[model samples]
Target: MSKIGVVLLNMGGPDSLSAVEPFLYNLFSDHDIIEIPRLIQKPVARLIAKLRAEKTKHYYEVMGGKSPQREQTEQQAKALQNVLGENYKVVVAMRYWHPFTEEALRELFTEDISKIVLLPMYPQYSKTTTGSSFNEFERVFKRFPQVPVIRIISYHNHPAYIRAMVENIKEHLQSWESYFFLFTAHSLPVQVIKRGDPYKDQTEETVKLIMEHFPEVSYALGYQSKIGPVKWLEPFTDKLIEELIKSGVKRLALIPVSFVCEHSETLYELDVQYKSLAESLGVESFVRIPTLKDHPSFIEALRQLVISSLQ
Candidate 1:
């Protein structure tokens, strides 16, 4: 029997404080991310990375000098490997950091795999996330044209995925009488949406599906992680939280809808920064639900998706 290889794609975080600057450089250097001319973008990206390195390093330090994204992704990989058994080889391909997508593909080419499946951990489709990684994979896979490949770009509204999210949110909401559901996803530049990127659409759909599962709960969707001066997706999470406080929402639950695993964004930004802000705003019962991170339901979702794709 021909072996099957599965490649999991994600935007990786810096493994150490010292690697933060270079990680940022790589992130901004990608044309799919910044969309600037290569000649001018490289130098500008370098400057931005250097200027932001210290501040970015502080966030990493707060999260214990490294990002748990790689570790969480590894756990997911192992779980999938266990389910798929001996014939399938699972590989993690992070876009911006160690175990990079290109590097991972190069290494996998040496294995006895006959076919490859590209499954990005991102549930929603985004040019900066899934598109960027897919582009890199295609570029590298060109070197080995003999190997067949299949790709699962997005599974945002799959029933099992929605179920996993519902379960996680309910777990955090236990015993809370009245609370506002703050569904947050990483913001993208407004220009990207204008260009017809389906990210905002898909993200909204995912939130909508999850919202449908619990009609009794009041919820609002917002975008987070806005960088630079350009406008991003509307009703930013921080601003929305403030608004919710003014509206007499005391108890709040923040759900990271875009991320499936904990990273700097969730660990530091949401847990630390947002929690502090919620406390300052006098909001009681500020709870941030954990990312999907190796949840059995999520793993089963992956298994089902892969098995269907193979057929």
Candidate 2:
């Protein structure tokens, strides 16, 4: 049997208490992820990273200074390996966190694997997010002649993926009259959109498909997690909530479209902060559908992505 590999891609989190600075530095250093020219990129990255580290450290502190994504990614990888059986080996490569992409790729390369299918943890296709990681993987993989081939799973209007999201949302659906379906995703700077990044558009496509699944529901799209002081995708999540309140909306159903798993942005920002803000604004109820974590349908989606790429 020809040896094949599935290298999972993620925006990694800090592995330990002390690694936070370097981890954030590595993340902010990526021009694809945080594009500022070399003139001030280093100084700017260092300054923001230090500030973010302090604030972000609190979320990690709550989770014991670790992201459950590592454990979850491992579990998902093992399950996928089982589904793929002995035909392929599975591994994870995080962009900034522990079990870095370099480490994962090095290990897989040693397994004599040729050609890899990059199953990014993100469902939707975004140039900055998924594409950045994919590009990096390509750059690194090119160094090894034996590992010349790579594939990226663009994403997720797949039936299995849709089914997984729908099922998860269904479980959390609260009985309310005319709920606002807030499709939330991580926001990118407006400048990037002019460069044709496609993150916002990709997110819109996912929300459209999801709202299609529920024709009876009235929905709205909003962007979240805008870093620094620059314009982002409009109708920000916080502003949208306030707007909805003015429009006499009392109930909302929020979904984090850009994320595949629950993290600080999802748990703290959305679940804790946004949820409270909604309550304060007289929004009757706000329910967030959980991320697809070890869900059977999502597992099948990952397997299908890999197997199809092989074909």
Candidate 3:
């Protein structure tokens, strides 16, 4: 029987402090992430990576000197493979680090694979994330074009995915009425949205679908992980937190709406940095609902998506 290859695409993080600079370089070098003239892109990436290495490394150090994204993604792949049985081979392709799209393609090409499914781990479609990964795959797939491929662009409002999000939020809710829910996603530049990226709209739709489970709960959407000075999707997560506190919102529950796994954004930025900011602002109870990392419902959601794509 011919095996079906399932590739999970994600933006990988440095495995250790030593890999930080190169990882950032790889990230910035991608035109999809940072638009720059092709002739000077590498130089610019190198310079930015060098300047940001120390600060980025410091964040990694606090989180045990590495990122858990690779491991978490691998676990998810394993779960997916088990669910898929022997007829399917599930692999992970990290965009900016090791186990890249090329590596994943090579691995699957070695198998008796008849078809491939490109599944970006991102729920919301963004040029910076899913578009970048798909573009990378296209670039690398040139050498290995034997197998047919199907791509899942986005599942922001897929029923199974929406169920998973609702279930995750329900698992973490304590005082649903008292705690104000803040759904936070990775911020993108306003320019990107202006250029017609569907990320912002899809993220809002995901929030809407998840909120159907709790009509009585008060919730708002915010963006996190803003970089540089460019205007990004707002209100920013940190700013929103402060606003909530000033408005007498004593309790807040932060939801990682766009992320499926815990990474620097969720672990350090949201858990450590934003948590500190909230406490300092005199918020009584601040809770960050965990990402849907291999949650049974989320795994089931992936399984359903993969199965549907194959049909």
Candidate 4:
């Protein structure tokens, strides 16, 4: 059989509080996620993971102590397989959580797979997310003598992706009026920006395209979920919201553009905490738009990406 396999990659979150430490350990140990020098990588990684796990668990607990990443990725994988026709098999592979990259790679070994494709759900090319997943994947593949020859579908920032995002915004915004079109993506530390990571720039470009597509979006593009004192992209979403309230903007429509599937960040951090903060600041209305999962354009984008990679 001329086997063709697609590995759908993502940064996985813990499913429970007990899993938090190990989950974060995997995330922190990756040089792509945290650049602790090789000399003290293990020790520093353990320490950071242990520390961050506590706070991260709180975020998860607030949103029912888990994230929908695994299920969402599985759904996407099934959908992609359908779109790619019955021949292409796609596997959900995560960096830190369940259906781990190692496990996914092992699954490939059992199959008659020859040509494989790597697909990161992340639209933005970030060393911290897609790069990190690929780095781990390479590590796993090196263990095998004849690793299935693979081609990678790099970030597909095509017009279809932009249209999917814009369509979601337009559909959701139809019900609201006089609200700020707040575009929020996952935040990367400022150090990454200084180190020449293109995540920030790519995000900004997406914002530009969305704006071009929808001229009515008086949106402010900002980053969210920055941890620690290390400077992150600003104006940060929370700070931006507060600033907007101060500037007399009473209504807001926030969308987590970086996240295509709902997660703790979107559920609790944005929905609950940010909503509470906005309410306290005397803002009358604050709503968060859901991610565009199973949206026709998004699935079509994935299908196009897979087909393009195959050829």
Instruction: Give the Cα error of residue 24 in candidate 2, in Å.
Output: 1.4
lDDT per residue (tens digit) for residues 1-311 in model 4: 65688898888778888998988777677887677698888788799888787878888888787888888878888887888875677788888888888788787667777777888888888888888888888888777646455545344358888888878877877655477888899999888888888888888888788778656547798788877677778888889889988999888999887887888778888998889988999998887888877787888888887787767
Off by over 4 Å in 4: 145-156
Tell me the whole-model lDDT of each prediction, alpha carbons only. Answer: 0.90, 0.80, 0.92, 0.81
lDDT of 3 by residue, 181-210 (tens): 999999999999999999999999999988
* lDDT of candidate 2 over 1-311, digit per residue (tens): 55798888888776677877888888788888777788888888888889888888887787777777777888888888889888689998888787877788887877767677888898877778788888888777766646545666577677777777777777778562367788888888898888887677767877788777788888888888888787877889989888988789877888888888777788788877888888988887778878887888889988887887767
Question: Sort by lDDT, best first: what order?
Answer: 3, 1, 4, 2
Predicted model with the maximum TM-score? 3
Tell me the TM-score of model 4.
Answer: 0.93
TM-score, every prediction: 0.97, 0.92, 0.98, 0.93
Which residue pairs does candidate 2 place in steric collision?
60-65, 250-284
Error of 3 at 195 (Å): 1.1
Q: Count backbone clashes in candidate 4.
A: 0
Poorly placed runs, candidate 3 (over 4 Å): none
Candidate 3, residue 31: Cα displacement in angstroms equals: 0.4
